[model samples]
Target: MLKEELPPEAALDGPPPDADHVLQRTLGTVRRERHDAGRRRGRVMAATSTFMVAGALAGGVWLGQDTGDTVLRGTSAAGAHLAVQVTDTEGGLRLVATVDGVQGGEACWLVVHTKDGRTFTAGSWRANEDEVTLSGSAMVRAADVAGVSVMNHDRTPLITAG
Candidate 1:
């Protein structure tokens, strides 16, 4: 048929549509779209979890860096008074033990230890000083020993003194 010979209504309905073919194409498109959406959601979740873990690790590093050296020393006598010293290197905080009416013939020894396994031992003479100084790098902790008790009144324990 010549192009000019076709009527207007015939041109309007030029090609017959295929219903089954159209439905299949539409269903395939929907399925692909749903699959892509699921993949996008999974990626988002994985990215979020990665970010959370990284943040936690960064926070832990910051906390560890902020904490510095600590020192603990303890002195005690047989049926007498007890003395303790606690120092925080990060904050330069010092707490001296208070012992009232220490009598003669009192046996006392000061044992100092660090979280990093550094130990310092001194006799009652050193404990009599106003302040005992600890050197080297270590995390101060309470010293554990028999016949003596070390308690942390303030700050974290980095060593144990017996």
Candidate 2:
């Protein structure tokens, strides 16, 4: 080891210089760091929780949505194509349909058949163009539906779904 000599002005004092201010500044810096760390942790936790809630809500909606399909397709006597999909709703069976090759100003009717041999006129529409899409509900159960038919205004069966 080597020894060095100190000048007269560099002699040690009774106590360390500025010790009080140094200790206070150090403690203040540590407190600020801790506070910032806590805030960051809180933000991370909040974000995670929000994502979890959103994910759970989305998952629930997806699980509760309808997944079954009861759809039938057929060609009409007048060279029209028809598709009818039935779904169970609160009041009855909901019908969603698409009909193509409809003549302008042609009146059409939807005929619903039940397993118990009951028939119902579910809905009707007047086609104004070549293609028509329609939706309606009827007092029939989807499970009890046996067939759906699209008929003309004269009661002629245009399309039949069996």
Candidate 3:
């Protein structure tokens, strides 16, 4: 409506529309907006988690096994599989091991068994999931290593690779 139709108290010259008055939203509209916001947050969280995991995996692949000179893969009757990348270093053997089909949180050691019947622990760690990748080093030279085994804390061999 034209300003001429305005009541005297509501004229354009009057004080600007109630400065302290707040706008109210309907209950359903508010609920819907909140729900939409929650959905957006959930999506963002999922994407961030995925990106972080992928970055970690790629970094490991680039820095670890992809640089190894030899890869020894093994399997066990118990359904466990282990792949070890063996790199011969002046100090000994550098081992990058990836194990699968194991229960999470099981304590395991990457033991390098030498040709002369000695065992050197390269690395030991508890499993995180069905699959895990880790690095360890043994004082024994790579040529002297007869085999590698993933051994349980109780001395059982979960998997072996030669």
Best by lDDT: 3
Clash number by candidate, in order = 11, 0, 0
lDDT of each: 0.45, 0.83, 0.84
Instruction: Please say which candidate is ahead in lDDT: 2 or 3.
Output: 3
Residues 1-162, candidate 1: write the lDDT tens digits. Answer: 898896443546543353366655787899999999999999999999999999999999998884442233334443324445554555333334444333433333344444454544432332332333322222343332122222232322223334
Candidate 3 clashing pairs, residues 3+ apart or interchain: none
2 or 3, greater by TM-score: 2
lDDT of 3 at 68: 42
Across 27-104, the per-residue lDDT of candidate 2 in tens digits comes to: 789999999999999999999999999999999999898868699888866688889988888888889888887787
Ten contiguous residues with the weakest lDDT in model 1: 144-153
Q: What range of 10 consecutive residues in model 2 has the weakest lDDT sum?
A: 1-10
lDDT of 3: 0.84
